[model samples]
Target: MADGRVDFSTPKGGSGASRAVFAHFTLRLDPDRLTRLRSPLAEIFDELAEEGPSASDDVMDVTLFTMLYGLRAGTES
Candidate 1:
């Protein structure tokens, strides 16, 4: 590997199963909150999809999700 730890090309498992089976998950978001998030998510995807190849490299998904998560949490709380 480029990081000098392990080769990604190598097989890391046997049955190809993920160890993170719903661990440390958060509470379920109600249907109303989910409906509210849909439009914003679509807008984000649409904006990204229409961007040119030379677009800025500073865009971050975590920041966007964090903002949305905070807004949703505030409304529910």
Candidate 2:
């Protein structure tokens, strides 16, 4: 994504009696917002990690993960 190439999973709505979906997105955050976002997001992920093992098994695993990342080595500046 360093070269500005972002990725997302195609939204899916399964053929079922009720509506369901698995969606994903990538977004560009303004530089100034990064600091404000990191700590809260980390705490959320930590809480989820702690609660994960006790979650009931009737549903599949769902996750929300994010990171601060850099572009691939050969990408443009």
Candidate 3:
């Protein structure tokens, strides 16, 4: 969000997530580092996507999971 806008017009393909998403913005964060970023990332998606009501931008409802933990790696899995 610091700069530039996301271009949802074109998409690429790969073996994993890159196959569907047109972009992959990395977060300099550990899965266990608690933050408010999770909400806006997965929550607002459905409101606009609407379960793929159209023939395009209709990807499956994949698990949009997020995690947060202490600064150091913990014993938790």
Candidate 4:
């Protein structure tokens, strides 16, 4: 999405013509995982803040929002 180059390998017969398709699949998978990771992290962050000392919320929110919103663009970006 950021106009960057990625290197990935696939099955020989399914390789060349599938570069764009496979890259799209792999990129989509990472965001799904990231969104999953962020959900629990946000919950833990909220609990920690409620209990005692905690990290900065603004930083965390911005990071998570950026990631989630960025994923909406998909590989076409």
TM-score of 2: 0.40
| Best candidate (score: TM-score) | 2
Cα error, candidate 2, residue 17 (Å): 16
What is the lDDT, from 0 to 100, of the residue 17 in candidate 2?
39
Candidate 2 or 4, higher TM-score? 2
- How badly does each model clash, as a count of residue pairs? 0, 0, 5, 0
Q: lDDT (0-100) at residue 17 of candidate 3? A: 42
- What are the models' TM-scores? 0.36, 0.40, 0.27, 0.30
Task: Kindly indicate the candidate among 1 and 4 with the higher TM-score.
Answer: 1
Candidate 2: list runs displaced more than 4 Å: 1-32, 55-57, 69-77
Give the lDDT of residue 47 in candidate 1.
86
Stretches off by above 4 angstroms in model 1 are 1-25, 55-77
Better candidate by lDDT, 2 or 3:
2
- Which one is best on lDDT? 2
> Candidate 1 on 2-47: residue-level lDDT in tens?
7653323323555665422222435567778867877887887788
Go through the candidates in order and give each one's C-alpha lDDT. Answer: 0.51, 0.57, 0.49, 0.50
Candidate 2 lDDT, 1-77, residue by residue in tens: 38743333333564433333344666577656766777787888889778766546644445455556433448668
Q: What's model 1's TM-score?
A: 0.36
lDDT of 4 by residue, 1-77 (tens): 36544423454677465333321223445666877867987887788668764466623121122223333555754
Error of 3 at 48 (Å): 4.4
